[model samples]
Target chain A: MIRMRDLRKDFSVRVPAGRLRREKRLVSAVDGVSLTIEPGEMVGYIGPNGAGKSTTLKMLTGVLSPTSGEVSVFGLTPVPQRTRLALRIGVVFGQRSQLWWDLPLRESFRLLRHVYQVPPAEHEQRLRRCREMLDLDAFLDTPVRQLSLGQRMRGEITAALLHGPKVLFLDEPTIGLDVVSKQAVRSFLAELGATGAVTVVLTTHDLADIERLCDRLVVIDHGRVVHDGTIEALHARYGSRRSLVVDLDSPLPAGFVLPGTSVAGVEADGHRVTFALDETSAAAAVAGLVAVASVRDLSVVEPDIEDVVARLYRAG
Target chain B: MAETGETWAGETWAGGTRAGAIRAYAALVGGKWRSMLSYRASFAAELLSNVGATVLDVTTVFVLFRATATVGGFTLAEAILMTGLTAFGFVLADLTVGNIDDLKRYVRTGQLDTMLTRPLPVLPQLVFTDLPLRKLLRLVFGAAVYGVALAVNDVPWTAGRVLLAAVAPLGAGLFFGAIFVLTASFAFWWVESGEIGNGFTYGGRDFTSYPITVYAHWFRDLFAYALGFGFVSYQPALALLGRADPLGLPAWAGFVAPLVALPAVAVATLAWRTGIRHYRSTGS
Candidate 1:
């Protein structure tokens, strides 16, 4: 379990004052943020640039001491009890490579086994699982520096899980991955989450990653939590409408009326129409559309989480 | 794989034991050694160049001696003994604890945060991860010079002299190790302060390369006496050579090299702990 109460972190930065002098100014990176994350919950921590997301993660992982307030990860104070807490937590920073740059991927894993002091049996079991799940066999012998970004990201996630940490913190795990690689990573994390063993808190700009993997989303802006709920709740909070589009075999009449829906847009001449569903379900809108027009194909598009989050940031 | 509750029941969340820590260090150091060897040509070049650098230091002493009978009231043999002792200590520290100078880069690059996440002491992890195995040959060369210096300086066969000769190098290594750590700790407060530490570590090595009498009174007093670089080699060499201090220090001061190292080590440890607390992780 992770619990933080009114956590705050401030950094003192030096700025030029005049021709021959400099001044120190205190900047609040994280201010009055409070949260509680239960075990086995995969939460997406999202924010704009410099939103104190990384700072909060650092404080949670014991890398940075909080300037004020409280933090408890697995019932231990992160800073004073860092070594003790480290045994149960794993961190992956996508922008950085934790593996030895010159050694083969397998060598880094083997070294980490000793670094974490895992029993050989458990280590081998976890390695086998990661190797199979993450498809790491092909590049196991290749030096980390030679691996592609996608391959290296897989290796990094594998390395973090070898010790079976109770909590996993990933910062932008899919930041630079290509489409195929991103899907591979998302599916792997989805399966990992299905096991309900590790509590995952990940921060990323990729809403697709969040939409596919996270059941809960926590959005912060300018060092404060502006929204914390499910994605559908976020859509409702922002009044973002869900739209249903239909491809009709024939164009609807100029005075055609579909009840409980409004025309969001018309595309592909009059053969296609997008209906913004009101408080009614997509089924009701589809039935109303079928009754009114000869529908060939139709699909419902949920409210864009990205736009809702953008509005959340603007409000914050 | 199935999610097994038994795995969690069997999990050991206890902190690693001392034996486990040792295994961790060995594993980290061994990984570094293999990584270094992967670039065969660079490894070979670094080893040779490291030895060459030590040879240059010894050659400079010899070249200076050719111009004068004695430097600051010490014969060439005695000066060489001081040089050998300084080299032995500095090289030992350099080979083991010297890479700490990269703390600035680690902080700037956010590598230190990665290290802090590991369930081990950060210092040992940093030292072992980049252990300078290539410097092993240079340490051997420094020891050889110390051996030759002892042979050239006769009258160093007494029981106390034998013990001093045996332990002084180790003392100097500890002293220099302290200096390296103390200076590297400055990075936590000032990330751009890289070369500032070299002034104390390498600067102290150069200062104690000759007899303290060769330096001006205030200069010698500052680095040699006040900072205790004198005890690293100069005073210890005096004890081994059975010589008196020209500056009127007690004879037993030479025997207290190890004693001097203890306080320096303590101060360095304190500085390192305080610095770690002040570490403000770099923004992502």
Candidate 2:
């Protein structure tokens, strides 16, 4: 389990006062945030840029000490017992690599085995699992520098899991991956989550990553968690409405509108229109539209998570 | 089951034990050595260049000796002893833990974050990861020079002298190693302090390469006595040579090289701890 109570971190920065003078100012990156993560729970931690997401991760991983508050992972204090804590937690920073640049991918894994002191049997089992699941056999002998970004990400994920850490923290794991590579990574994480042997906390700008992998979502803004619950709960809280797109047989007269729906967009050809539906079922909305006009084709589009999150940020 | 595994794995990991630390260092250093050798051509070329550089340093000392019968009241033979001690200590440190001066680069590149996440001491992790096995030739050359210096001096061997001879070079290595760590730690607070740190680590090596009497009075007082570089080579050389200090210090001061290292080691350890505590990792 991971527990944090009133955790905070403040950094003193220097900004130029004028041409030759500078002054010091204290900036609170994480401010009095309290959170609890249970074992086997995969939570998606999302926030806007500069929302103290990285700061909170750093404190939990023992990379940075909190200015004030209590933080514990499996009952061990992070900062004072970092080395001990490191044995139980694995962290992957997507922007930074933890592998040796000049060595072959296989060699980096071997060295990490020694660093983590994993038993040979356990190490081989994990390595085999990772190789088969992540398709790492293709580039096992290739130097890390020569691997493409997608290949390197797969190798990184493998490295983090080789130690069998109880908790895994991923920051922007799919930041720049292409479509197919992103799917591979997402599916691999989903499989890992299914095992229920490792607690995973991941932060990403890709909401698709969350929707596909995480069951619970935590949204942070301005150093505070503005919302925490299931995706449906978030949609309900923000009044996120589904939209209906209708391809009509002909154009409707100007100012002729559906009784229970609002017009979201209309195609230039006037043959297609989108309506925002509230509480009304897609069946009812389509029926009402069909009664008013001849419908050629129709579909319902789920609420955009990006739009809901934007509204939540505005409300916060 | 996972909770039990966490506690059990933490116990077996050996990160908190002496044996564990040793195994970790060996793995890192061994990996780095192999990594360097993988580029056979580059490793061979770097080895030759390293030997050439070591040869040049010795040639410069010989060239200076040709200009005068004595430098600062010490003969060629005696001065060579001082050079040998200084070179041995500095090279020992340089080839092993000297790469720590690259702390600024690590901090800038975020490699330090990767290291901190590991279950090992950060200083040793950084040192062993970049261990310069290519400089093994320099260490050999330094020991050879010290050997020749011992033969030419032809000083009568006493029990105490033999002990000092063996212990002094090691003490000097420890002293310079502490200097390397202390200077490199300046990067934590001031990222641009690289050049300033070099002025102490490398500059201290050059300053201690000659007799303290060779420098101007005030300069010698500040760098030699005040900063403790005097005990690194010159004072220890005087003890081995059994010569009185022309500057009027007690002869026993030469024997205190190891003793002098204790304080430098303590201070460096303290500075390193403070620096690690104050580390504000780069923004993502």
Q: DockQ numbers for every candidate?
A: 0.57, 0.45
Question: How well does candidate 1 score on lDDT at residue B55?
Answer: 95
Worst 10 residues of 1 chain A by lDDT: A191-200
How high is the lDDT of residue B162 in model 1? Answer: 88
RMSD of 2: 2.5
- Poorly placed runs, candidate 2 (over 4 Å): A249-260, A266-271, A314-316, B1-17
Candidate 2 Cα deviation (angstroms), residue A217: 1.2
Task: Give the alpha carbon lDDT tens digit for every residue of B57-173 in model 2.
Answer: 878788998999899988888988988988898889998788899888987776688888889889999999999888889999999888899899977789989999998889889
Q: Judging by DockQ against the true structure, name the best candidate.
A: 1
- What tens digits encode model 1's per-residue C-alpha lDDT throughout A65-92? 9999999999999989988888899899
DockQ of 1: 0.57
Q: For model 2, how does the per-residue alpha-carbon lDDT over A1-316 read when each residue is reduced to its tens digit?
A: 7999999899999999999999999988888889999998999999888788888988898889999999999898988898988888989889899988889999999999888888778888788888988999999999998999889999999898888888889989998999888999999899888778788999988999999999999998888888889999999998888999989889987888676788888895899999999657888888877888999988899999999998877876
**Cα error, candidate 2, residue A141 (Å):** 1.4
- lDDT of all predictions: 0.89, 0.87
